[model samples]
Target: MPNNGCVAVNDSTFELHLKKPFQPLLGLLSMPYAYVVPHEAIEYFGNDFRKNPVGTGPFILKYWREGEGLVMRRNSNYFEFDHKGVRLPYLEAISISFIIDKQSEFLAFLLGNIDFISGVHSSSKDELITRAGALNPKYRESIKMITGPYLNTEYLGFLIDTSLQHVSNSPIGNPYVRKAIAYGFDRDRMMLYLRSNLGYPAHSGLIPKGMPGFTDSLKGYSYNPDLAKFMLAQAGYPNGKGLDPISLSTTEDYVDICEFLQHQLSEIGIPISIEVIPGAAYREMMSSSKLLFFRGSWVADYADAENYLALLYSGNFSPSGPNYTHFSNDKFDRLYRKSLLQSDDSLRYSYYLKMDSLALDYSPIIPMYYDKVVRFVGSDVEGMNPNPMNLLMLKRVKKIKNDTYSR
Candidate 1:
């Protein structure tokens, strides 16, 4: 195999040749994007490939009805076995509903029409989850809240490439201004009120709380309006007197969070304006470097910390890669290169810490919080545990037969 291609040694094996050594190769290959789709399946299904997927996973596509619903049954030919020697995929079938409204989805879950609902949505969050981030005791007997660290870090990225005239003209291009914004707002307060205390304040490096390289070892910004004022003044804008209104572009879903930041930053002498954009359009603008300051979040495709760090790598500058900030640092690049060559976990983590430290010091991005996977499951569901990555692996999940069960 050459250039990004792989070779199949046999029906059971395939291998890829990398130009350089990489520590996270295994994790990278484990991603589902490279899963093999059989030629027979494609030829047979033709335009119906999306509805009739053929893969080696533990589940098989049973049927789909456009936007109405979908069903997947356990693959009888699957080879995997459990610790107890039982064939994998204990659940007979998965029934997925297409409920567009968040509140309606919540109601479906409450009425036993659905097994679980993912994340804390604004519509039904306050009714089910208390202000303290606990499931209200009123429905505790029939509902269970499964919470865990999610491998996602929500943040705001700044276009730090001063070579661009727009960036040079804006106060946001200044490192001090970026650091000021990072320190201006109270992350804990934002989490408590807006997020219902569902996430941890990003008080550490960008690797997030659950990933391996994530450590309290590297310091990050926290609430400090006084320091924010000092940093703003250091950026040559005294009390935001001559500073321009920095617009934070975000999607409609996260407008509330951006508004919260806008309010808090305004009090700290930093005028912040919120730009609400449609989800698809916002993504296009962000990836193409069309926006200077934007709300973004990174979810791990693999378990490696490189996925997050790659966002700041110089070679990954926007339009072609993920580096929206266009931040290039010689020291960070060297460390990142060295990390790829390191096979030892501890040594690689040390490099990660140093790289993260460098990125945080520059303050190209203001990490808002490390998101948490919050699942509201019906009491009748078992083995509903979610991992840090939040990949839905339903092989071990089972639905306890209940009289009230609807699906």
Candidate 2:
């Protein structure tokens, strides 16, 4: 009676109406009232409730006034206890105020109005660091700064649809033409001119330098206009003479990168027009295969090399899957399948390397640059560790002395 759609209430009784089975229905029933309530109770409570929190965390929401501020009080009945067997959240209360402006937020941090400041805007990083350095000279050892590599990369992809007008219909569909385009763009110059040396030029294969299976042995598309032109000619578009005008579509955030790429391609005699589209519109066009060429990136969901290769190289596309390039290679697909089934790390990494090498050679998507997770924390915050994934684990965070509130 207990089919895939049936939910078993007990060993003998099958709750067929319920789609998912409850593992500990009776056990959960006997637990404390605090454990039974769902965390998203506020959403179901509707507009009537101002603060309807049902969290098991150390702090409980007390009040919230839209865009103004929010206040939380220590949860006395929280499951976690200190070494002394007392409830955690050593502070009295927490107050979070909204400051939309970065300048005002930095000022608040300087005045000790805020207990912590997580991420600083890219534009404000230099000024914030300078201010922090100046303050550190006077108040030695008061603040702690930590920086690390992020598990993210930014890349540009060429649209593969052959039906769209104004879209490059030449060898863009051919593996050699795509590889030529990858080689045509000077990644080093782009990083210097657009990113201001904040990003490292993508030289190694798709997995990034630090990640496993990544190899400097497998060189990426190097900047060689002559070679690119040669490949283009081989693909039947000699000096991009008879080719249609290439339109590069991307979000506003990456317009500058597209422009830089346009300039680079023009040097190689490829006439590229830049089209600045909104993020949503750009995504739609990419999904429908309407855009000629588009720019995008992916942050690793997990540590596996398959996370990068399978999404872009395998026949997976967006709106349904992760493959945006619409690239499909039987060899790459076979290698990816074998990598997933293999349990040994060394074997898996070897297969991943092979796949990455193929991708680099074929050029489904051009690897641009690896990203870094940059953030600024206030002096009063302690035990704040930054993860490569850029997620904040507030449970491990603690406030230092002169702190009036704790999260």
Candidate 3:
């Protein structure tokens, strides 16, 4: 391992080092030896094999049995201490068991097996809420249900490919075709059906509402089948007779949304073919640009308009690039560059608004709805804070003696 962290290593060098058996093993153990491990067990494991760990965290890894559970013990040698001079992580041990089945996980929670459960799935939200409410009023106060707005936003994206290109050298590049598609669907009605008024209808912009630089005045498309048919016919796909069947791909979670879109588009004379694939396969197909239209969601890596705008319209493509729609506009790109260079937040926000306006006008991808992060925590756990980014901060959390206790 290189002692100096400033220098960059090429891909070939990384691959070569990774392939060396003992080198990779040593690399995994090196962090602990440096006292950088977050838990004690990690270091202990490294030391048992003649390697050493330098981790100084509150917990130490004790045992890990594959397909069973992981056990971590509180580390007395942990560097941090409370104001009263007591060691952190008051609990003696922490155990994590992988329960792939969510229903089983809920049952375990009911049986008092786990201290906390993060990410309550959308399908189980109603049932979980109802059950939690039905408990004794005193018990309900102890059992915390953390809910917050999340940065994640879901959308339907159109794939630009050679098959859809026309001889005008522009092909399916016509903005009218994109606009017609956007207008064909009834987003609000769909949200009511699928999410039960929990979601907001999408406008034709890349920056979702509630984020900085988002504008309600720049609404791009609304539910108007008549207008959609007119635009499609104007784009020369009258009654959808000559146009090829449009394919909409999605994962199982969004199949219902796709089906609703399929029905709505049918009303506008646009035949849509639904392709429901596994999540991993769907992502692979999307990256390969094999699917014409697909469903995707973006969870913000940071709280910035640039994070959302740059990903979808920056004229760049991925692994780090998020221009999944392959949308390119010189005006938007120029504004984005200018915004990044500006040091002042207000100036940057002004440029962001301009960029957002341009993106809405172009109508590349159809925005869906922003998501919410929901979770259920046990009655004994306290000081658990949930952030809008969907991160659970449990460093200050401690188990209480009983349901009535609070810290």
Candidate whose TM-score is highest: 1
Instruction: Pull out the clashing pairs in model 1.
Output: none
On lDDT, the stronger of 1 and 3 is 1
Clashing residue pair totals per candidate (backbone < 3 A): 0, 1, 8
Which residue pairs overlap in candidate 3's backbone? 32-53, 32-54, 33-54, 35-54, 40-60, 41-60, 41-61, 166-171
lDDT of each structure? 0.88, 0.68, 0.67
- The most accurate candidate by lDDT is 1
lDDT of 3 by residue, 1-407 (tens): 55433223552232223322221132233332333323345545764532333344677778877678878788877767678987776778888898888888877776677767876555455656543223234547546776656777788776653344531343246667777888899888886677654546776466665565666777667898888988898888887768777777899988888889889888888888898899888887777656657788887655676777866554666434667667777778878777766767688778877876776667667787767656667867777776656654444678777745541
Query: Can you write out model 2's per-residue Cα lDDT over 1-407, one digit (the tens) per residue?
Result: 54555554654454435443432233233334413344256568866544675556777888899889998877777777667876676666778999889888877766767756666555555555543222224333444555555666677776554444533444567766776678788888887666655556788777764455667787777799999898888877888878766667788888888888888888877778888888888778787766656787878665556778866555576558777776777899988777766767788788888888877776767888876555555666765676656665454456667645322
Q: Which scores greater on TM-score, model 1 or model 3?
A: 1
Segments of candidate 2 deviating more than 4 angstroms: 1-63, 71-95, 118-126, 129-145, 161-168, 208-218, 236-244, 301-305, 313-315, 398-407
Report the Cα lDDT for residue 225, model 2.
Answer: 94
Mind giving the per-residue lDDT tens digits that candidate 1 earns over 88-132? 889888989998998899888877778888997778877898997
Give me candidate 1's TM-score against the actual structure.
Answer: 0.90
**lDDT assessment of candidate 2:** 0.68
